[model samples]
Target: MNGIIGKKVGMTSIFDDAGRNVACTVVEAGPCVVTQVKTDDTDQYNSLQLAYGDKKEKSSTKQLVGHFSAAGTGPKSDVVEFRDMNLTKALGETVTVDEVFTEGDKIAAVGTSKGKGFQGVVKRHNFRGVNDATHGQHNRQRAPGSIGAASYPARVFKGMRMAGRDGGGRVTVKNLRVLKVFPERNLILVKGAIPGPKGGTVILHK
Candidate 1:
């Protein structure tokens, strides 16, 4: 997918052309610099590696410094690649939200969901616990009930759904329409809620 690495600037509402209020997520999409470009002849594939954000030179590792040095740019806080881009050039370039996308363009936003630590079966997997509270089930309110048929396999199945960790996983919201694009600020206002918290890194794909 052709896209930009951005930070979620939170969400707000804006009026459309017809004066209808539209809920949108504001993202600080790149003014991303082209750090490296892979070609079919050399790397056996085509891709453009983009670098964004700023990092302190003193704190950067040698490998990262080498990578940034190869780009002729200082060390960046983040780096991501857009594979098979439609550009003819190689490196030392910039791509903003305005260049590849515009208002009404269908897009997909990918981000990591908020972490919800060790949860119960009801909350994590939406499993219905013991429904009858009055039927001598004093301690069965949040219980997962019998895990399986007794002694059938003499052990819990490997793939059986149970309570554990939830959330904090990769999530993608697809077919999101771009409500507006601010070229000067390199911002993108996309329709609807995106995964992850405010100021979180998100990949906007088209």
Candidate 2:
């Protein structure tokens, strides 16, 4: 099908049988429980809600506890719904890493990028500032040069690139190769990096 909920378990480099080193990101994939199944007739769409990682009963909210109860599972620390899944023969059943993917499979990862807060035009938008650094340039060295023509429109256009927040948004990287799949440990090693920090949650799709 399309998806799996996984945890980023840091990165490592391993040598292949050919004695070539490969860089990979190890991820703890599944052993994920099917918490809820949404069907077209019943829920107006088709999807499966998978839950991973456990939490104390006391730490779970009533709604989450009830959701888990419906699935005959314990409270999970994370639950993500995957839509339009197929090639997954089991629903309301535990899905292990082996069932979803294998080595050398091509997949995509979606994650939130790391945040870079309150940056200037130079850093944020890559604007080239005043070139005359020696001729009394003063503070215009880092300033946004010309916002607009002097009097034509007389206003800065909307959607002009300016200093602001960067990152911390949904980013998808496509065509990443699966370097390894360890079903026993519920781990999958992708050939390259995914987004976000070390422990961020990422959704992998075929």
Candidate 3:
């Protein structure tokens, strides 16, 4: 498959071959179960749907439980599809990290960024606020200034970059180099940081 589901296991620094201390984010990649296969004739596209993480049987719906039953596995928590992933595995076959990725290979990581709820333009949009703290600029230092004109187009623009909500959005970080892969431990280390908080789910795609 072209991708695998993983959990962010946090970050660490490892010494590379050049003896440089390389920082990397640890990801607990899956030995994911192939739950379903889509074909061009059947679904009008070719893709593989995989399931990851364990879910309590009682917590799952009967339909999902029966779906897992067909795959010969218990209820799963996460289900994701990777398009154009060429695979001919059966419904219950497993795919591990080592099979798809190798060290030094550049890949992409996708995840939801950590949420920084309602924020201002300074922090959210990186707007330099006023640039000076002179006179009576108390709480107005970080305020977004001059949003709209006075009369003509009096309304604020539709796609204004003003702050409302920040982060907790799906982010894709590409060109991250794979530093290490431990298939036995179901873990892979990638250069630099990935999105989301600790234990958050991520997808590593080639």
CA RMSD per model (angstroms) = 1.6, 2.5, 1.6
lDDT of 1: 0.88
TM-score order, best first, reads 3, 1, 2
- Candidate 3 differs from the real structure by a C-alpha RMSD in angstroms, to one decimal, of 1.6
Per-model TM-score versus the true fold: 0.93, 0.85, 0.93
lDDT of 3 by residue, 1-206 (tens): 49999999999999999999999999999999999988999999988888999999999999999999999999999999988885567789998999889899999999999999999999999988875677767777788988898887879888888979999999999999999999999999999999999999999998
- Clashing residue pairs, backbone N/CA/C < 3 A, model 3: none
**Candidate 1: residue pairs that collide:** none
Model 2, 1-206: lDDT tens digits are 56788888889999988999989998888788998888889999888889888889999999989889878888998888888887454445897878888888999998889999988999888888998888988889888777777788889999988888988999999999898898888999998899988888888889
Best candidate according to lDDT: 3
Better of 1 and 2 by TM-score: 1
Name model 2 segments beyond 4 Å from true: 55-60, 87-92, 135-138, 149-154
lDDT tens digits by residue: candidate 1, 1-206: 68899999999999998999999999999988899888889899999888888889998999999888887889998788888876655578788788879888999999999999999989988888888889898988887877877767788888778889999999999999998899998899999999999988899988
